[model samples]
Target: MRTVRIWAEHSPFDLKDELKKRGYRWSSGDEGRPKGWYVDIDEALEADEVRYLSEHIYRRDVDLFTQIITPFERYSVRA
Candidate 1:
């Protein structure tokens, strides 16, 4: 899964809204990280798609990490 974490030095919620404008869907992280917010691609993407997204997407000060989500986890996150 291709995922990106968008956070800021201040105004974390605003950063997440910025991510949404660029087509990323935001979610607070998995179980242990209740406060961490992120945007993710729920589906498995093709290699080329992954490359294109990573290269073309404009990122600011954000933590981009791969999110490992189970079916239940996905269901729990507020879309």
Candidate 2:
């Protein structure tokens, strides 16, 4: 199995409430995770996730990471 994690890096303070309402949890940067809002979902949900995320996230605030091994590799999308 693989892990697909989508992140909202440097997310605007304005969106925090909506993000929480939408199921994104805030990370305090503990356990080597970035400080921001993120959601862990299966890869199958990527399109749906992107659609929802795109509603609140702009290009500069997005940071996507997939875990295949140590030190997560970064990926990008138009969100």
Global lDDT of each model?
A: 0.45, 0.68
- Candidate 1: tens digits of C-alpha lDDT, residues 1-79: 4343332222345455654675555345464553443445544553433454345443333334454656666577575
User: How high is each candidate's TM-score?
Assistant: 0.35, 0.64
* Tens-digit lDDT track of model 2 for 2-78: 54677776767887898888788988998677888887667778767777666656534343554332223444332
Question: Which residue segments of model 2 deviate by more than 4 Å?
Answer: 1-3, 59-63, 68-79
State the displacement of the C-alpha of residue 56, model 2, in Å, after optimal TM-score superposition. Answer: 2.6
**Candidate 1: which pairs clash?**
none
